[model samples]
Target: MRAIDITAPGGPEVLEWREVPDPRPEQGEVVIEVTAAGVNRADVHQRRGFYDPPPGAPPYPGLEVSGVVAEVGDGVEGFRPGDEVCALLAGGGYAERVAVPWQQLMPVPDGVSPVRAAALPEVACTVWSNVFMLARLRRGETLLVHGGASGIGTFAVQLAKALGSRVVTTVGSAEKARRLTELGADEVVNYREEDFADRLSADVILDIIGAKYLAQNIRALNTGGRMVTIGLQGGAKAELDLGALLTKRASIHGTTLRARPVDEKGAIVRSVVDNVWPLVSAGALRPVVYAEVPMAEAAEAHRMLDSGEHIGKILLVR
Candidate 1:
């Protein structure tokens, strides 16, 4: 099978396409003939050597994939050969084939394409785990998302809004702000022009940009508000003040979907399949594909994500 290997850590150029051994499913896992893979910011971080796949994963990048089942391992039931499934992978999604644990599998919602299904796992699981499960963002509460045009941001917009939260987003430009509004944000802040901390108040903040927005999150949050930081795209380090945080009873939660305990990830997957998949099938929630690149050109996909000019998700098609 052909898979992407990080030739070395540096830029998108580091992603190398090469022949690798085909995967064989382990117990409780299933082998998938991958049709598409989602490109994520974490893939970029891994490409640059800031992150590494856990043991037994493809040393290459890619965190989620949509594919057809080829084989099912012992103990796995209710799915078999030819099932169209998408999985939230811990790693190893950047290949023609991948082995997924039964626990991480979800059926491709009706009417959702394979490419869109590939885009679903990472951001959907992330948003579900953070905003819904952890933060418990309530309907009618004001929620602000930074980098609102991003994969996670776009999904955050739809899911948060669907659940009744008034969504606001901070984007880099007017064009992106406009795009975010289409994604369902009630308010859009062009971070290049307006200071989000001063202009918009939020009861809950979902932040993809880290350190740079840290202090502002404190200043912008309502009392007892919570901020979930899922990515540090802007920068990881920043100055923080304890006084304001204490005063507002604000809490900043830094989270990553990958590297979570398998059982826990499985639980989130189950809940989302039951709760969110219906919305996707019904057209209430959609996976936004900003660009699609062939698997061999995964680097180009990475470049688009890094450019920050795109809205929604990017996919590496098989």
Candidate 2:
């Protein structure tokens, strides 16, 4: 087996593809022969010596993958060798083979190819958990997503619209705004030209900008709005206005999927399969893939993600 190893704390150049021992399934786990891995900002953080994998997880950087089951361990059921599946992982998807808890694996939705299935797990679970589940975004409500051109952002836009919410998103450019509109966003605000906060108020906000958008996000919330912060790409420190939040009766939540327990992840996976997968299968929601780089050239994939030029997910194919 071969995997992308981070040689040191640094840039994308630190990711190296090298031969590694094959992973074997443990109790309630399954070993997958890698097909493709989803590149994420967390992988970038991992390569730069931040966001270490949880205890007992693989040392690789990837957070999601699509692959074939090669083996299953004790206590695992309902899945077997040769099964085509995509999984949400804590780590190790950037390898030729990875062992994952069986609970996190999901069958590829109908009409989606195995290669593209690699794009679904991470973004689907993230949006479903944060926007729908945590924020309880209801039909007719407005949901605002930051970084609308990103994998999570793109998924969030489509899923919210498919579920009957009015979707508003923030992007870096006009081209991205156009793409988001095509993806079903009712409104797309170019952050470079306008302030999203001044333009609209939302019942729920799927924010990725963290500290930089914290104050503005509060101001953009409707009364009793819920704001969930999942990424800190814009820096991690900021002041919070308690007066504004109190006046609006708004709430803020901070969450990270990678550090969650397997059982918790499994619950989210189950929710996605039940609620989100049907939409994907029925063509109401779609995976947005911007590029597919070879597995060995994962650094190139990382560069693509960092460039902010892509409209959706970038995959590393085996």
Candidate 3:
């Protein structure tokens, strides 16, 4: 199999496609002949040596993939060779093949192509777990999502709206703001020109710009609000105003999907397949892909994501 190997921690240029040993499934796992992989910020972090795969996981950078099942291990049921599926992976998605636990596999939703399915797992699980499950965003409540045009943000906006929540999002430009509003966001804050905290108060805030938005995110929270921080695009350290938090009776929760145990990831995957897939099948939610590049051009895909020139996900296809 050919996989993208990080020669050394640095930039996208360091990614090299090279021959690697084929992966065989362990018990309760299945081997997938990967057709497409989603590019994410975490992949870039791994490529730059900032994030490491969990112990006993693959070393490659991808986190989600779609493909046909090639083999299934002992104890694995409900999947067979030739079955098409998408999966949440811990790593090793930038390859022609990957080994995934059966629990993380989801059948491609009706009317969704396998290529597009590759972009759903990571974003779906991330948003559903953090915003819906953890933050407990209820119907009719205002949910604020930072980085509104991003893979996670795009999915969050649509899913929250479909579940009856009023959505607000922050983006870097007017164009992105318009796009997000069309996707069901009630309000779009142009972060470059306007302060998000000044424009709206939210009952639940899904934030990606960690530290830089910490203080303001608190200020923007409605009383008893819950804020979930999933990314650190804006550095990791910041001072929290305990007084403000106490006054508002608010709480902040920080989370990441990658380092979790397999069973926990499996639970999230199951929740997504059961709850979110139906919305996708009904067209209330959809995968937003910006570009599709050949697997060998993984480096260029990474470069495009780093440039922040794309609105949604960039996929690497076999």
Candidate 4:
């Protein structure tokens, strides 16, 4: 199978597309003939050697995939050899085929195509686990999402609004802010021009750009609010105000979708399959894809993401 591997630690240029061994299912795993893969910031980190895949995970970059099952291993049930599914993977998504644990597979929701489904797993699992499962976002509350036009942020906005929460977002441009509003954000702050904390107070904050926004995210929260951070797009090191956190009775939780256990991710996937998947199928929430690149152009996809020239998810079609 053709796969993208990091030749050495550096920039996107290090990512090389080459033919590798085919992925075969081990016990309790399923081999997916990958149709599409989603590009993410973590993929960039992996190429730079800042992150490594866990034990037993694929060495190549890729965190999620949409494809059809080609083979199933022992102990895997409820999925056949021809089922169309999407998986939240630990790595190895940048390939023609990938072996994913059965626990990570979920049916492609109605009205969603394989291309669009490729964009769902990472964002859905991330937003559901952090914003809804962890933070417990409530209706009538104000939710602030950093990187509003981003993959996770775009999904965060739609999900927040669908649950009847008021949505706000901070973005790099006026155009992106406007797009966020169209995607159900009640207000959008130009982070480059405005202070998000001063512009709006939120009952919950779903942040993807961490550290750089930590102090201000705390200040922007309402009393007894929850702030769930899932990324560190901005520099990771920052000071925190212990007094301010205690004063507001706020709780700050930092999580990474990829680092969680398989069982935990399975639970989250089940939750989405039961609830949120229907919303997407019903068009209450929509998949936002900016560009669809061929699987061989993994490096270019990474380049586009690092450049931040696009909005929403970038899907690499196989």
Ranked by TM-score from best down, the candidates are 2, 3, 4, 1
Q: Which ten residues in a row have the lowest lDDT in candidate 1?
A: 53-62
CA lDDT of every candidate: 0.89, 0.94, 0.93, 0.90
Provide C-alpha RMSD values for all models, in order: 1.1, 0.7, 0.8, 0.9
Return the TM-score for each candidate structure.
Answer: 0.97, 0.99, 0.99, 0.98
Ranking by lDDT: 2, 3, 4, 1
Error of 1 at 163 (Å): 1.1
List where candidate 1 sits over 4 angstroms from the true fold.
Answer: none
Per-residue lDDT over 18-54 for candidate 4, one digit per residue giving the tens place of the 0 to 100 score: 9889988999999999999999889988899999998
Off by over 4 Å in 2: none
Cα lDDT for residue 24, model 2? 90
Residue-pair clash count for candidate 2 = 0
Report the C-alpha displacement of residue 304, candidate 3, in angstroms: 0.7
